[model samples]
Target: MPAGLTVALVAGEASGDQLGAGLVRELRRQVPGVRCVGIAGPAMQAAGCEPWWEADELAVMGLFEIVRDLPRLLRLRRALIARLLAARPAVFIGIDAPDFNLGVEKTLRAAGITTVHYVSPSVWAWREGRIRTIRKAVDRMLCVLPFEEAFYARHGVDARFVGHPLADELAPGGDAAAARRELALPPEGPVLAILPGSRRGEIERMGAPYAETIAWLAARLPTLACVLPVARPALLAPLQAALSAAGVDASRCRLVEGQARSALVAADAALVTSGTASLESALLGCPLVVAYRASALSLALVRGLRLIRIRHFALPNLLTPTPVVPEFLQAEVTAARLGPALERLLTDPAARATQQEEFGKLHALLRCDASRRAAEAVAALLPGYRAPNEP
Candidate 1:
């Protein structure tokens, strides 16, 4: 490998930031002095990535939101593409921003620059036609889920299942007692972790319902203590307002900024907005009920268009052979339904045991030293790149 090989990376959101950071660390370990540059969040920047743009610029979610920001996003993409074309990095990795990165990747790959898409778009689950666009966009598709690699291989796309970084970060079993100690919670009492969602949009849709669920749980279980883990500080005010409006006692709720994993580990059960948090709870061995509510138009459009191919949306159910946790969506996401589901997980020993047992298997399947594998896969695309232990 060259002495100063420049590797460009673009991560769209917080999760991608984390994945990018891990990949950066592993790449640095294997190939010293590798220059990493592109759109990054704090984590990626902390791991020596030169941030050309803040990741939050491309962090917009939902079809409507993206449409609203389309012009700005397009301009950002054009600027990024021009810069990359001029710099001509050895490899360009797009981390989870398919809408933005795939276009950039396609253009760069056409220019003879090797491109890798770190997280495969959910083409396998929905919008299977995207496979065609992905084929042209990336030289390699690095998938976190096992099923994704199979889907790509069947379609003849060059792909590898590098496993999920979260699985490697969180083990099958967690020390609930230790987590409680860290959170300064009573070790013996019932605690619920409420994760409405990370995005402002998610909080807007889910905060009230989640708070209501918490209030319902508190009413049922007198000793119930709640922990709300806010991904961003901005989410805290809205969450608190929702909880207060729901008549939930603020004194009984501990609103903590960040430390989401710790809250998951410490809780007896969690009421989480369906997305990555469901997977995190499962990985942490925390049984949870997943709930999601989007804008009425968004849900209607998704249902009207038949966009979702899969029956299940939660990560745990998607990964598992069968549903291991309950999922409430749209109108079904009421506290009357979610509260009972969470209550069952918290109170029923059999349910908790079954979930933990399945979580162990899920963990084993995904704990494949993901960061190292991702780095190795990226390195293989570079000229003169050799494995660290190769002679």
Candidate 2:
């Protein structure tokens, strides 16, 4: 069969790449021999996308960081728009990365191409004004959270609660033994997994203190081992340097390229940096202590940003709006504070079990099977787009 429709999908970061990969697989399954192309990481490439460029290079975070890289990003985006318009795909699917994808999508939509933004921008949080921009860009918005549907409806943006791909991907049970063996962990001791995020800026700002917190906890609890899962080896150099500079041994920590699922599943508890990891940790049934720190400028920008309805940050807590996880931010983040908080989470079996049970409920709520819904939404835009698994 020949390709009847073409899809240009753009996914800027690791999380977005994972979502994009899932969407691609579903698109192929639903509409076999669909031509997929655009900026993507390895996973999406494996799903049969001919990359216009590596999606990693497009990953510039925070307002200030993006400002510094604006000219390059703009040039890249313009080139992308041209290629996409030339190819004239049946639809353009922008997966997350709202700051970057939304603008490109807006341009493509104005040029008469059907546009779909896979993940809704956080209008439910800060920057509610962008809902209008989303309406301008996207014909349909696929929301991962249930509450997001109401949020979009209030803002007059078309949306569907398509559930989260993570819930579908994560198996309920964990493999602690496999994780321990893979990382050469001690067979009988409790383990603490540390995920400080994948960005370079995150490592530089929070690395030293996070490592110090690990060392502090290790000293107090002789039986506890620290497992630091590296998002990328490049992001780990600063962390490794911090361990060396602080007179701590790197041998005390295990560094991994990824396998965040394994690390979280194997751990008794986690010291996670404030993004998607906290959510993954919950799904893995790991109790968590979330932490984050950014430069004054970026932090200030975040502080000044006018937030709306969303009150919680972590997904587990956000889902229930209950005090299920601990989030330590900026000024409150200290080695002394973090270590004790981590220790407390580790020691309390009842609390940990309660949180895990809550996460299980959250998982069931989010396991509504998103890809087919998203594909159907996209198909609604094409000439004769038929959804294979229509709901």
Candidate 3:
């Protein structure tokens, strides 16, 4: 390992952890001898990152959650900035998980460390003011989506679109047969997969309707097997309670913890609560009903920032908005409505074919080996680069 160049990276959530790991692999490939350190999860650590703290500690979501964790987040950011200033890493790469990464980038950039923000903040969606913050922090921006490049250019930020890795993985067509085999279930049966959400607040808000939707589907199609791939097991009891209150059997509902990808792969038609799962469902080539519900207060807070012009929230629909799948949001996120949407796709071959076609187009756009491109951008900023295979 070389002493002249060290890169400190911080990724706050599971998604960021994934992005960070890929970037580390790419960066290592470019500069095999460069020292890579700081807060990272399993993927980045596996890519040879030396972790200074648990990155999960910074994975808090939503407005109130941020406020609650503000002091700790600030303290962590200051500690990272101080260490970077003291040792002076040549470049600081802040992966997704904006709130945790942005301030660190700002402080480090002010202190003369080259800064790169690996993922653009949702400046295109809710916060227009973020452009100023991004400009103050990042020296270069690496964006996964194609649309983001234009946005960064408009704001005068150095940004590049390196293509999306999910696109590469899913472009080859989704494996429905393999998914069914892994679950040990017959493809003949009606399979309704429940993806509440990754965040606890989201799971709490969307979990009841999700379980209720499963119960309704199970009753309508008795042969239907419900698979709920839960994110936080702490909320599982409450979710099961919702199913019981609706007269749905807890035993019948197979709760598989940490099997989100498997659940998306196996389902005939998934009832996915909005967010990352929507994209995963599309990539898996599963026709899905997108349902999302937020507390009235949470809803009110989000409504305050109305910069979003996109008609579709689900990634599949957003990619090709020809009503490929039903998007039931807020009050429209009912079990009755979602159940039929899933049923329609499951029973109708024509409908599923149309969806599969659109999903194919979306997958093509996202399918680059994202980590490699991302790593190249980060490594290009480092000095004295060496390929990992080189002596």
Candidate 4:
């Protein structure tokens, strides 16, 4: 292994921040005095990464949103490229945010720097043509999901499945009773967890409908307790306003700041927006219904172009041999539709138990020590690299 190695990492969102932080810790352990520099969130900074820019700067989502912010994003990318070229790190790893990172990786790789993309772009799902861009951008691709490795292999790309970091972080067989006790909730009643998403745009799009679904559930099951976990402090006001607008009573619901995992563990079921949270709900063994709604233009463009390839959108369903959870998208994501799915998970013991059984299997499949495996993959790209314990 190289001494005093410098590795550049760019993580564009909260999930990527988490993956980057974990990978940074493992890399530091594997290579003593390793220097990490790039765009980072608080987690990565705490893990000893020097931030050229905050992760939130690159956190814009959706086609319309990206188009609006294109100029600023392009400028940021140019500045980052110049700085990285000057420093010439051993490897550059872009964690998630494929749209932004892939372009940077291509430029850096073209400059003769080894580049790794930490998360595979959804080439299997939409815009399959991105595979060629990915092939040009990365020396190696590190995927968190098991199926992605096979997809990359079929395309003849150098990739490895590091398993999922969330699976490793969460314990198998979570105790709902204990989580409820910690939240000071009754041990006997049904509780539903609502996680619209972590981003502001996500909250704006899905929060109102999710709150309405909660309201519907509350009326249907009088004893129902709803808990919403806010990922960031900024989201609290918007979420509360959305719930209020939906005529949801404050007494029937509790708004907790952070503790998303605890919220999922405590709930009998979850109403989650389709993204990383769906995967988290599954790993926590929380029976859930995944819901998503985008802007009219975005949905039209996606459907018009016929971009999606897979049959299922939810991560749990995608990983399972069969669809284990129900999904509502676009026009189908109505409170009326989502309410029944949540009700079933809350009321039907057989259904919840079956989902839990499937969740356990999925958990086992993804529980490989992900951070260490990812570090080993990144380390392999370095000249004469060896594991810390290796000769």
Write down the RMSD of all candidates, one decimal each: 1.3, 2.1, 2.6, 1.5
- The TM-score measured for candidate 4 stands at 0.96
Ranking by TM-score: 1, 4, 2, 3
The models' CA-based lDDT, in order, is 0.90, 0.82, 0.78, 0.90
lDDT by residue (199-226, candidate 4, tens digit) is 8888998988888888888888999998
TM-score of candidate 2 against the unseen true structure: 0.95
Candidate with more favorable, higher TM-score: 2 or 3 = 2
Q: If both were scored by TM-score, which would come out higher, candidate 3 or candidate 4?
A: 4
Name the weakest run of 10 consecutive residues (lDDT summed) in model 1.
171-180
- Which digits, one per residue and each the tens of the lDDT, describe model 1 over residues 81-195? 9999999999999999898999999999999999999989989777778889999999999999999887888998999999999999987557888988888777887999988
| TM per candidate | 0.97, 0.95, 0.92, 0.96
lDDT of 1 at 39: 98
What ranges in model 3 sit over 4 Å off? 1-4, 171-175, 305-307, 321-323, 384-391
**Alpha carbon deviation, residue 385, candidate 1 (Å):** 1.6
Clashes of each: 0, 0, 3, 0
